[model samples]
Target: MNPEKLAKLQSQVRTGGKGTPRRKVKKSVKPVVKEDPKIASTLKQLNVQPIPDVEAINMFKEDGKVIGFTAPRLSANIHANTFVVAGKAEEKSPEQALSDMLSRMGGGSLGPDSLSQLAKLTEGLQAGASGAGDVDDDIPDLVASEDVADSKTDLNAAD
Candidate 1:
């Protein structure tokens, strides 16, 4: 081997065969501000608590029947009494609706456990759609009584 090539090989072996030594870059970090003890003490004395999280109800209905219903897994805020339903749970089971209503009513504080019992109580409370229990059996049919008079009389008068 030539003397120059031997010196190059020896240098490469000493430096682990790297082309150039890499430089280490230092990262600049921003300093964090220290909290004032007086402010911290005042805040601690206030004893402010975070507001409880409330979940909204998402109801899905098909053909006037509830096909899907979702409730938040977390316990709701019982003191807050306003409930917002996405849509009418028209076809929902009465008990399920009532239970959801109660849960929404104040985060289930009023009667979360009363749903099944209330449902049982309201089972027979539905009114017949056809008015089958009405005492007036001779209720007039509005369509029959409607004055659907022909326009010929008005047309003759106009002529």
Candidate 2:
């Protein structure tokens, strides 16, 4: 082989020899998502209404001295506000948004009413289990063996 050709082939074989450096591929960056100004303005305009029935429940007491304190949960009546936002955002309904919020608050979508209903259901079940409930006097007796035989004969006739 020619000396010049051999040197050229050797250079090509050794990648790090710098024969025309490989081009680096540039990565595409995802664009930042901006929040809708209208939604922001609407949310800002709507004032957060505090829950009226919420009261401070005593959490911890050391020798009558309250040491630990649990903050009262604050809520807003965002019913109307939620509808406007949901409509503008083209997302879920206001009810769905409210249910999602309730679910996030550790209560299944049922909220406060669920606790009462659950308690009633539990009480009813307990009463039924204790045998204090009504007897099955109204329940009819099972069909006799003759009736079973008649039913089998009817099936054979259909075939």
Candidate 3:
């Protein structure tokens, strides 16, 4: 290779200017603004705790639920009772959803035997779907069947 070409290549590699593309700078997320100080104080009085580490809370949330622990700030006149706000767990994967559902359904209380049943159900569903059968069967027929069934049951019971 020519000395000039080699030097240019070396410079390019060193400076990351030749083949490397420039990355777009990310816009910073702005903090949520509470318009009313009275509302903020009310919330503060309710003893809503600030999450010590938001990143840790995020990690805890990944396992299905987030548990926040915080002491009320001394300045605020908080109530004696502790208040908790629970939001739905956001599952990114089917496995996570299944795990979360099982946990919610008292899988821990049922012990290892419950896990076996869950595994069997998962396997059966997978096997059933692998065939020519409709995948929609996995989903509850909420639109028509449930309402029809409920109406019929209600009518029969009324009679």
Q: Write the per-residue lDDT of candidate 3 for residues 87-156, one digit (tens) a residue.
A: 3334343344445556655744657787787788667545654553434457565566788889999999
Candidates in descending lDDT order:
3, 2, 1
Which has the higher TM-score value, candidate number 1 or candidate number 2? 1
TM-score of 1: 0.26
Error of 3 at 13 (Å): 40
Q: Residue-wise lDDT of candidate 2 within 53-112, one digit each (tens)?
A: 442322222122222212454445466543221212223333333334455565566746
Off by over 4 Å in 2: 1-23, 48-159
Residue 60's lDDT within candidate 1 is 36
Q: Tell me the tens digit of each residue's lDDT in model 1 across 39-105.
A: 5575455553333343444353322233333433222223454232232223565446656666676
Pairs in clash, predicted candidate 3: none
Model 1 misplacement above 4 A: 1-65, 71-92, 111-125, 128-159
Worst 10 residues of 1 by lDDT: 81-90
lDDT of 3: 0.52
All models: lDDT?
Answer: 0.49, 0.50, 0.52
Better of 1 and 3 by TM-score: 3
TM-score for each model: 0.26, 0.21, 0.26
